[model samples]
Target: MTRSLPLLAALLALVATTPLHAEGDPESGQRVFNQCRACHVIENDGRNGVGPNLHGVVGRRAASIGTFRYSANMRELGEQGLVWTEDNLRAYLANPKAVVPRGSMAFPGLRNPAQVEDVIAFLKSRAG
Candidate 1:
């Protein structure tokens, strides 16, 4: 039992250091983000396409991009303080309309949970 303590400690340390959104591969996420290319871009200082620019979007407030117009509901959510946390992103990605009924975004949703995680991971990578 004593011999295993060091291993356990090492594992715990790794868990503590790993980011919360590190479950998915950033590279895989980049590819997955291709699905969003039609409406959004994620590069640093990228411009908004059909959808709002997603650079540094993971922790940003909804409808807060002053350059892009958003639906009233989205603006209201921002007024209500809707920060785009990872979990919230997951929910919205799974069902945009369900999360924000009457929003103008038309992409239905990504049904694959893994793909959603990948996209979130990709977005997080863009934050830096």
Candidate 2:
């Protein structure tokens, strides 16, 4: 019993320290991504649209897609070593202008947090 208790405690500690998965639904995120289709593509071989192709974008350095022309601000951000982690994506999606004041992406923003989360989940799903 004493040995089991320590094992159980260690297991609990490991679980507690592990990052919790984001609660967004990837299926729902696909639906949400419909709104982004005019500009972005996530397929591995997808061509750049108004926005750059987003394959493997989840951890990619921002504005690094070679064929797409990025705004000076976007390029600057990338040069500064900004990787597109989930939290960074969330903030940028919530307010493009605020995140990169002169970025060329014209969309206003995703005002709904759930929608933002969903879109991010969709993007992450395609990141492989």
Candidate 3:
């Protein structure tokens, strides 16, 4: 019973933090990510274009895109243990400069909440 209590607590915590995107629409997100495709690629092909390839960005450390010259601000975030999670992504996507002032992401962020959610769905779908 004592051990069971701990297990139940863990399960509850997991449930509480579970993503709303667990059943999110990946296709919709894919379409949204298309906007980013112009500046970024989310494939694992090691392609570095204007922005870094986001093949496995979720759960990855910020600014760790290999061979890509990140802004000093972004590099600092990477060194500060900033991992890419859905909430962080949403905030960042809403306003890049707001999240990281002087960061090098020149693209204007997605303004719609639904679009941001969809983008997160796409990123999660591609997470491997």
Candidate 3 per-residue lDDT over residues 20-113, each given as its tens digit? 5545577998998888888898877768888899988888899987799989999998999988887788889989998889987888899888
Could you estimate the TM-score for every candidate? 0.81, 0.81, 0.79
Whole-model lDDT values for every prediction? 0.90, 0.89, 0.86
Off by over 4 Å in 3: 1-23
Model 3 clashing residue pairs (backbone): none
Q: List the residue pairs that clash in candidate 2.
A: none
Better of 1 and 3 by TM-score: 1
lDDT of 3 at 7: 93
Error of 1 at 48 (Å): 1.3
Model 2 misses residue 17 by how many Å?
11
Q: Is candidate 2 or candidate 3 better by lDDT?
A: 2
Q: Which ranking of candidates, highest TM-score first?
A: 2, 1, 3
Q: Native-vs-model 2 lDDT?
A: 0.89
Ranked by lDDT from best down, the candidates are: 1, 2, 3
Question: What value does the lDDT take at residue 13 in candidate 1?
Answer: 100
Candidate 2, which ten residues in sequence have the lowest lDDT sum?
A: 17-26
How well is each residue in 1-128 modelled by candidate 1, as lDDT tens digits?
A: 99999999999999999876547677888998888899998777778888999999999999999999899999999999999999999999989998899899999999988888988888998898
Using TM-score as the measure, which candidate wins? 2
